[model samples]
Target: MSTVPPLLDGPQADVQVLQALRTTWSDPPGWLGSLRAIDHKTIARRFIVATFVFFLLGGILALAMRLQLARPGLRLVSPEFYNQLFTMHGTTMMFLFAVPVMQAVAMYLVPLMIGARSVAFPRMNAFAFWVFVMGGAFLYAGFALGSGPNTGWFSYVPLASSDYAPGKGVDIWAQMITFTELSALLVAIVLITTIFKMRAPGMTLGRMPLFVWATLVTQFMVLFAMPSVMLGSTALILDRLVGTHFYNPARGGDVLLWQHLFWFFGHPEVYLIFIPPLGFISTIISTFARRPVFGYRAMVLSLVATAFLAFGLWVHHMFATNLPEVGKAFFTAASLAIAVPSAVQIFCWIATLWTGRLVFRTPLYFVLAFFVILVAGGMTGLMLASVSLDLQVHDTYFVVAHLHYVLLGGAVFPLFGAIYYWFPKFTGRMLDETLGRWHFWLFFIGFNVAFFPMHLLGLHGMPRRVWSYSAGLGWDGMNMLATVGALAIAASVMVFLVNLAMALLSGRRAPGDPWGAGTLEWSAACPPPPHNFDTLPVIHGREPRWMQQALPSHVAGLAADAREVLVTSALAARPESRPLFPKPSVWPFLGALATTMLFIGSVYTPWAVVWGALPVTVALIGWFWPGRRETEQALALEQSP
Candidate 1:
């Protein structure tokens, strides 16, 4: 039988081991080591920053479009340019910013929250972030070259093909879909493995943190949903470049085929953007309200139920496409059925606030805003669920208003709360409360003023994506009102930026548990050490920090010399084994760079796809190559810590 050495035997041994771990796990000195770093924190920060940059770019596009539409006949931009602007704006926001940002937040927080030292596959995590960054850059490059896709965010066929849409623009958009889908798929698998295998001992499936549970469910959704778009976009690129007629009606292809594939992926994409925010709301409410989340099991079931029902309602998006009436009725019912889970979540939040002491901080304020806005969005969703109503307002600004409400209210508002709630944990500094309040009110009022008018304009027969309209159409006043609101929204974002910048530079230091929170993440040092815990924590109950129970004994057999973490059973999170970690390497980044060449080059010729695989294969081989000898040497030569 094998016996492992004690990682912590006595007080002195604990100090020696912790000091050694700090030296071993911390980022190596100098720029070269920084470049080679594979730490999850480093990569998560990169993902967040990169996704924010895309958000800024996409927001600029929105403002430009809003400006042109501020008046009845403004010619600030031509129709073609405006088309490109909206398409790029929608595509960037949904694909490049919203979904990726949520995943980035998960990447940064999941390990810390779950009491894991690092993500399951740190190198793979880094690789996914880099791929997503490169893909966003490539798509924007097409915009810079005056070749951004004009077909739409969904890129409906024939209009997206070379015959109607010549040039490398649509091809660029299609290939970027493949890049992002691959990135999403990779991150989902790694995160799922991490959550299942790396939770602290005694953090059973039921005991898993709510955000971790939300992330687990979302990743599962990603695993099942991403392939449809990946396959669709691949076929689109192939048809455009090589004359394979996957979407061509002349070649016996159905026009509706693109709709089927895209919506199948697209509908779930909304929930993928949404489900985590539900977790964020639950966490923030529970934290500030001084209570455990009400209806924890019901919330988990609602998340899972929402994910399942999300797939069934994709057909509702095609209500105006002339599908059978029976099919339309089924989709309509499914779409409306989704409202039940959402209402359950919101009412649970209200119920929590009803019974507990409430702290109305910036985060909680945003959560409150989410409740009001999500309900408004959901009501419109119910309206649109009817086949007849969708036909009337299918392509109008009403649809636009509904989506923004759902997304901004449902996801972005909660995300703001999440950022506020976790800012201290990540940055080791508290954001200014006064400034946070200003940011919240400005954003909240501005968001309503901007979108609420769009509903009126949509009802008044204002179609979406049009550069300008006739002054006689009643849309002029509402459009002008929206423009004013848009400016307010932009100003609010500026306020947030200023507040964030000030806090990072000069904010007050935060305690490990600034809000007296209950989760494991708050148990670590503010901006936690490289080796998260000096000795791994033993979790006893759900609210580890709040229970006031005697702390459980730390695990003793882990090696202090090498990077070692315990792997646990999936359900009970019982200790199963220890796994050695891979050293920092540049291969993941190199592989992503090589893979990017394939995506970008394919826009020129299909031959690039075959050629691109060679470098990628080489990079993968090197990435997975073992360092068994060096690892053993490091472990054997180590003194007793």
Candidate 2:
């Protein structure tokens, strides 16, 4: 099992095997097939598209808030409506859009990069997507019905408690967290399994792509960081719905406990959003600079160190709260210390760019933007790490500016670059270079104009989360300027949409390896086939394309008559066995429906948890029920290949 099996030959036999694979691996025909499809690419494409739609929706919410704040005392929206607007904007961007989009891209790219046909737990992967859809839909449905959560995205209690904020809105927010976080945990499991046990032969832990390494690191962060929020949200919901005293101060519960749990996940949440983008930056930099990333081992170590240090910095967010001076000092030290690893990564990327020939494609334009914006953001982050600076700027537009600079610059810009870099691989065409440059410049300039003034406004004593302000408070000009810049951002997004549409329609067709890339993903056909590869590739060196200048360079002995993916050891990546992956089913969709009922119903009465379990149990049973064909196939492949 440690080596590849013999290749199939003979024209007639090869034809039959190939045909059987087409039959076995292809989705069932028509719309039904589309619904039941469990292919990683199918799920990832749908997941990615769904997240982008959420991103646009979140942006709309942001623009509305901007319009309301465009001038002092605008009164365009009531304070109540403004609350929901800002609340949903933050919640949607953080929960519905950013984190999931990164995973969605990883879901698509990881399998191809590792030369696996599909992610591990394909059924669970499908389940995760449906669950995510339900969660997002539920949140928006609440908003549409005028029951949107008015509590901030952080939803701090006392303000969020049942006594003060009594409604179904907070309940919806809490339950939505359950759905999204559950989906995230499932995805983390699927990705971790795929990376460790399903990598192509000879791709040991060392030889794995930097993106894959980043993904592996990010998922581990998810495993540790996600549960705290899940627990905290569940407690918040219980306090609201079930008469629990988790956050009720009068009931002997500590309000700060909520903060403890939330920020524990919250600060790491920043890294959760950014680490994958680091991967995107590394990939784009190496590909465009025409060399392997400088200090590859250092880059990998830096990523790991970043995740490790992210947990320690969460306490810094609570510096202004009633905490010990010693604790604040420790977090400040930890916060400043994290810059070491981050700076290491920056210097390594600089070394790679400086010594190598550069290709300034649209993707690189976005990547280069990351340095300017994120570095500036990082400087401000360091400033805020000081308790005095945080106390001065806390709860003000300065904090808002710092967050946007970090998240937008760190994640969003890199993500756009990734789309340009990989769009040809996703679709069979390239994005228009002219429109791309326009999109980048307008977006970059607009982002700064809209946000940078917020820092000065904060310094001038303007608080965030305000519905309206006095007319002559020295804020009108900056407010108008920010509004104009936001409009520019909206326009840039429109240009991007046009570019996407035109590129999909009649842009130049792409080759298998458009960038002359060195990774395994480039070895597949453009917009690769459903099975990914005609032959499951074996790895030789880190850059498989360069090491073995051939498409899909691996021996073939897998079962063509059934769905099979190679499994390997975690460290050396020695071949272990070929396991049969599950096929498409409607059960996951049904299961999500049943689970949604349980979650939403629990919002009304605690009894929902008691009775709702029945249908959920039934759906789980249906989901796991084995087919006769599957049993036979399993028995056939239980031996050596």
Candidate 3:
């Protein structure tokens, strides 16, 4: 029999390490306990669930939009309601759903794939989830009170000014922006730190999994880019409440400032959403095909180049506003330059598939769809990047079509693939392939049917964001077709939900490594143990687990030992031997509740903001405060057995 030493029984064992291990394995608190479970898997699941809820809400808003615009003179909703629907729809999907879902997948899977016990900052992960939940609730409650934000998702200035809006609507929008961005920023920091510092031993930078690299790049982009939008929104809020003139055009505020600030964050935001999905596709493709990613070096370099180039292309969104010709040319060139790296990635993916033995699975189908749709979006983007072309098609249905293709195709499609791929890992049961295939084809066809005709409608000169249109423009057929497509898409989504429900209830139980994936996540028990691994894994190559499995057991045992190292920094790789990571607490939940009160209070009474702020601040401070007992215990445990 194999004799493994008990970790808790070691003479030199640290008490805090034991405490932390116990905490990590403890049953999550009821209702609130669920929130405190900071395991990467739990956090990731929370991210997916919360974001999916927001996605449903966002989709409902989209349906409302389609109903209102079903025909040229349909009065399904008022102009004001239409504005709120689109605005909230865009905001919810982009900020609340797309980014968070991507991040959630990362949070859950990255640590397992990279062979780490938990993320670098577990508490921060908990905090981000709570804050995001609170933010979404705030926005939803605002709508319930008939004060839904009507500013476009971008909330362009003057239109968003207090005088034009003159209500609590803009405040709700700004606060939602603040709340969600803050959560995203925290996630970015956590992921970046974890990626840089927490990989298993021998996992060099170049040898790091492609998903890790993609996440690293995306997090850096979020870290730097999110601030510009946050600052701009804050400025807008100040203008509304304190009479600041930053974006108030009549008071010497530049209307274009909002554009600059928004796109600064906005352009990179596209890549932030897309890159992680791309990473997911890369990992899934290589694993199922049993091949290393083609042009791995080139793929990594392309990601780096794309990250740098993304920031420079934001002004392409503002090309129609009559900027100086020189500035416009600069942005246009920058925008075109951004496409080169994307093309490189596409080429690399194609090469990988061409050389490898391709496995045709439901996930692979989604990846294939992603490639097709993303390419269409990229072509439209190239068209829009040109100053002349953009001037003609700006704010038209072309832009709408382009945005949907990129966001939905690039982010949502690949994410669906990832969910199907990882569902077994999360639920301990395989998702029904037959049902999943149905979901994929229906969504794929419906999605194309819905958005494809928008390009033609745009070319025929249908401006976007208009609640009603005149029927004689020859636009009614396409609009009606698009609505039908939307319903079809909805139906497909329903199928997916039903499939998920059936899978959870009584589908075939999954086996460990069902897909023969290369990463360490597949090495563990399906639905992995509460503490992940009893012993940390040793990573040798990008496909560590696969390589380990190929070797003899004795060799694999040695490899595991060699791979095991405390998570630490990339610069030094010194082990952070401290044990007993912070245990779960009710503080995050309490903090979120208090903050929600503050947001709702501000909407009704200005002084309510003050009252709301106090409890939230107190709750946060309490949450972060290190109780003397735990601190001393931690210190003692770190010092001695």
Candidate 4:
């Protein structure tokens, strides 16, 4: 009875139906199937989670440093431990936490906002995550083994060499940088491809979200700028490991070359971290304020201009290093040029607040805080851009203050704001508003308290990286105040963690569009579907989902189900052929495992490096393998169906 009942199945019928089902369910050939399987949301979630973990690790390192510096001349840990702490702290926070998190948020949100299913190169996206994980592990293992990089995150040459440091610490730094930058570069490539190639039917580049545009600019910056530093690190690694003379001053190696390469990537890295956050602030302000972004064109142009200008100003970091007067003046002028774009962004943000309805949600609070703190940092940056002023403040607490203000305000503040804004979308639950407010207030106040006095300390002749200083230097009161602020910031972070945990565990369910967000992501399920949308909606303008809601429900639903195709250009409204969705595979995870071994093996023995290379090569080959001829024939039929 079972044999006859199920689709009238004899062996032939059974075979036919099985083949038909396989044809129905199977994905197309090439890497596309693997890519489609991951989807944008999964990739984005991976990016966010991995980055958050790195943030926790980096934050712990920060707390350790703070404890050590809490008092004058009191040793909380050994000097070596302190060195590793600061280096790992800076490296982890900058490379692992800040930049990747920004990209992750963008990755998750951008395609959804634009009404696309997945990013271009979804497999590559998975690969980037694996590389980042491997890189972080390597850094952590190196630290545990007492071989953590000690040449500072920048890893100046002579200090990093075997002659001076005499260990594998610098090697760890170089390798970590290599792995992380490779990850960044991969992400950049994937993002650029997605943004340029995969917008919904009616979404023009001009009509794209400001955050999308900022991300696009950021990807280009990452592609061009990151490689320079990667190259520099490679050079230094060679010099350390194989007796190359690239940075060996005694052997005609120029330390300045290291400075050039580092800052070349470093200065733009500042914007790379800041711009996405700025984009977030822009989007949040406009949404909460209930107004269009002020000077949208200007904001977009400024972002582009900033990327270009960022490269020319790297020499500003070298002002105190006895560079030629001509070189100094060139950098000084280039440094000042950066102020133009920054000022443009600031003015636009202020204008947005002034004109918009300006609701004071938790996210908006952080944006407001960012405005105050960022202005303070920008002013210092302007001052530092001046050759004489930079010379006076270089290597001082002022520099430290300036960087923290910029990073904390520019990156961290907005990062919190983004978390608040998007928490509902990620978890399908609303974060506790009261706790969020508490977190914002505590963080904002504590942040200023911790960093504001550093400017005074810098002016009073206090230098950065000092283990301790005498109480008689008039730095005691400020140091004590700073410590208090640091503790407060730590408490605020604790509150955030608690809030996140509670929200995930038992928070109230959220609406699809909790904030009345204009983006397409808000139109879907709270956490979104695995495919993101059942059908991608055609985006006609900047606020597609918001506009969709204004239409009759049936009309909007019809619009949502249109057969979405990727487009190359807005002007022509050309449609590329629809492609099949990706299917899940173990290759990405296996590849990550191989890469991890390579990094970890390098730390243990030189022979381990050789052995490590084999797995990576094999995994990559398997990852890209075309499969059997029979599988290919079956896939070709499946693709047509």
Candidate 5:
């Protein structure tokens, strides 16, 4: 049966349709226009590139720390500087790189996969990106000024308070948190709305892609999880700036309050950095394995369950803080129980590979390595979930090893896989396979070599965040080995960069469906058009392209003379509105600038809070004001009387 019936009768009609779409959906031309762009693709590309730049910068910090720790008593950096390096490294990896990069991937891929023209809140998407960029810039500016926060990424209070921290560095860190969390929260809201409201016609709840489902759950996590940190940071800022004494235990404030609030956000922050990569794993596995995911309903259920359970595990990070016994037991049980969903996902992927025809591309190599590395990390996590065991190694290298295992293994491994898998789709060219394999192996081996001995160091009682250790304590040899491994990992990253340069410059061209994938995105052109679709596809089932059938219908009647797209009912994707989008504007960027000033100004003086509101209010008013076109139409109607 014909999947899509001809909407236009002939060539002339098709040309007219194309011309109308091009005219209506076109972004403004020139560099200035590009700056004011609201196109999801442009914003997403900026996000992805900015994310990697931060990653590279963070990696350099990691290498610096490794060099300092490579041999005990090697004073590459002083203890104070070491503290700043580690704090910024952790902060950049978690806030500046991981979560934003995952969101960037979704920003680019989600609309294409779901057959939507653009994200639901296009202006907000651009604003989120700008806010993130400015926030990172603000944080790094403190570093450049030699005033980086020295406490930790968690920035536990009393230590991070004005009395002891005694600098603008901690203030900068606190405001950075506020900026980033707000940005993340806004992006999450937009993504959740888009998933629920902007799916193509007939792409019902059950028919949505697994990656989309994973993204939905992750954004919900971000929505629920981000506010706690923002609140905590705001309170911390108030304490630092105005002497509110929220963390001032001597004045009746409880130190444990910061722990509770921070961890409440912190533990889920791990999954915030981890879950979307799980989505990448499922998508890549399904495509390369040449089969439907082994357990679609189960995978969706597991993702939802994982997100819910993630909230309950936050208290586990506070195991050594001397909580009530029952509370500890409850949190430990919750932490351990959370692993069942992860195990289910792991087993399902393994079963899929066992039953299907597995293609071992560079992407799959990383996924395969993820299975080994992440499972190993999960095992260590189970160990740490024990209150007794956690007390023995809570602040030691063991915890460090476990974290990298979960993050690098679970998140970054799949991230690279997704990058290779989707690179062709985005750039219309193939990455060099030989270089890709080299990148994967060197990174994999170097990652293990660098992190594995930390397990032994922890077992031997090596505490974390120490600038130097005594050479006689049986740590020097392993530390040296780790340094070598860190260097290897750095080399691997350099190779990957070279390969990306080669691909962009002169790699073989990619076809639309380079991987013979089974998703709506593959049905579009490689480096798809500005309008996303020449004609909007009507989805019939999951894996529409897999079935090799035309879309069951096309979303017609959406005006091609203006920026109009279908707005659907939340559950069934029944069209509800034909909304017109505003043309790209510079206001979001300008508003973000205003907001950055508010955050930065508040760091030095509390009065900035009162004064900062004026510019912010003005910018927002200008941002949402009706366009000249809309005002003209309203004026014409009024004058007709």
Candidate 6:
């Protein structure tokens, strides 16, 4: 059996082991690594591409809806088909795109920013990505097979029950929710563990970057919020397939219970999606503004405070459903109260930009736009928080406009900026400036043009989800204008695609620290190595790159020839232990395949669950039944801890 290698030490030894380090940490030669590699960078890249591909698919569905709605009396699609388009578009973007994309980006950047060799559970991270892909595939496959969900992404009950909705479609929708939410939960656990136990020595909670703090809070939100929806979906599947009464009102299950469970997750879901971008905005503002962000402690407290209050306000979505006055009052208070933390964060970013030496890159332009867009969205949100006003425009185009403004403006714009800022470090190429500016202007203008008119249409009594409308309703003009803007948004995406293509193929090669940022990620080589850093950094401040002169260059004595990371105390970040991480294996992929079968098979027949469990059990055995070598290494590591 193989034995643990001696741990390497000393600054000179760190230099000497660079080549050995790369070799030791490199993926196995050929398909063994190519197909089953557990390296965070490789897995993160794949996760990112996969999520964006889903984003593109979601965008196509939206464009089709826009086309059908472009002019009154357009029969480009039937009402039935329109239902499919609307439902799948929201599902693809929410479950498949927005949430996953943020996790994907974080999965790539988190480890490097925290100065860890890999995520806390690299194997679990791979498994999470696979499960996410399979879940998305399961969803789209049903759509292709004419069994796609048409009951809306929310899939409210009575309508979603087997009585009203008889088909494989709702069954597929219920199952897919369980699938994607499981993937989300696993990833959240991976990120939380990494942030808590794997930070570099001397990087205390106070010294952590705002991005890292944001990631931590978001994951915690996921852990708490996701299970509510998962439980709701599971109960839904049981109700549909087994005749349970979890959501059936006549037999004692309340229809409003579904709303409660769903919105509990739903409202927090918006913040979880929105919060990460707050971190992205802060990082970009600090980088382009050339200063540490203003009010570090306040920013951290604001993030935590926002998370706590998000749960209390979910009942506001149920205001028109005849909730008690006291309950409505409490929820309304909650919805407005959450805005305080958000405004504080906004002010901090503005102050950072106002006082510092500013650089106006594509990322900064996007950040600047974020302020205007989110503030507008927030005002509408306050309006919606009022029970009296919301009763007027409930389920109208105004709600649609408000949502996109919050999601697209609050999340997507910043994501684009993040891409521009981090692209060089990721791909070792600078995205062309002129093309980026063109892409931004088109996207910004297109977004406003497409969404702004919807607010007026809503006020004019344009209820959403209508396949077509009469031409004389005074809505045609705005509808046409919105369609034109949709095309512009499409064109902007095309420009971004072109820019990305040109940069990857033949753009200017970037140097390490091309932006001269203070974060630890820029301290590494451009595009970073498979092993990340050759030596583990000893952090002395929030921006390790800026404090490099005062710090000890490297932390020594971790094993160089094994997949290992320092286990630090959660609060103080003092070194506690270095444990050997598992190597690349195909079992994660195999395990995902097994789980997918169980989920899909359960949709058609109940016995499939029992049959499916067999292979799933086998896959689990192959995955966690460690060999003699791993057992020996674990024993050795534990001996001295």
Candidate 6 has what TM-score? 0.97
C-alpha root-mean-square deviation, each candidate? 2.2, 2.2, 4.0, 5.8, 3.2, 2.2
lDDT of 1: 0.87
Q: What is the lDDT of residue 26 in candidate 1?
A: 73
TM-score of each: 0.97, 0.97, 0.92, 0.90, 0.96, 0.97
Model 5, 632: alpha-carbon shift in Å? 6.5
What is candidate 5's local distance difference test score?
Answer: 0.89
After superposition, the stretches of candidate 1 with alpha carbons farther than 4 Å from their true spots are 1-12, 551-553, 631-641
Candidate 6 ranges beyond 4 A from true positions: 1-16, 29-32, 633-641
The 10-residue segment of model 4 with minimum total lDDT is: 554-563
Residue pairs with clashing backbones, model 2: none
The residue pairs that clash in candidate 1, if any, are none
Candidate 3 local lDDT, 502-605, one digit each (tens): 99999899998898888778877888876566556655577876674443321111111111225655844345543455666777677777876786666555
Candidate 1: worst 10 consecutive residues by lDDT?
1-10
Q: Could you tally the backbone clashes for each prediction?
A: 0, 0, 2, 3, 0, 0
Query: Which runs of model 5 end up more than 4 angstroms from their true locations?
Result: 1-9, 548-551, 630-641
CA deviation > 4 Å runs, candidate 3 = 1-24, 549-565, 571-576, 598-613
Number of the predicted model whose lDDT against the real structure is largest: 2
TM-score of 3: 0.92
Measured on C-alpha atoms, candidate 6 has an lDDT of 0.89
**Best of the two (1, 3) by lDDT:** 1
Which residue ranges in model 4 land beyond 4 Å of their true spot? 1-37, 548-573, 602-611, 627-641
Angstrom error at residue 306, model 2: 0.5
- Could you give candidate 2's per-residue lDDT for residues 1-641 as a string of tens digits? 21112354578666766667667777778987777889888899999999999999999999999999998878888899999999999999999888999999999999999988889999899999999999999999999999999989999988899888888999999999999999999999999999999998888999998999999999999999999999999999998887899887787999999999999999999999999999999999988898889999999999999999999998888987999999999999999999988999999999999998998899999999999999999999999999989998999999999999999999999999999999988988999999999999999999999999999989999999999999889999998899998999999999999999999998999888888788889988789777887788888888877664555668567777678888999999888878889989988888888899999999999999989999999999998999998998788678544
Error of 2 at 611 (Å): 1.2
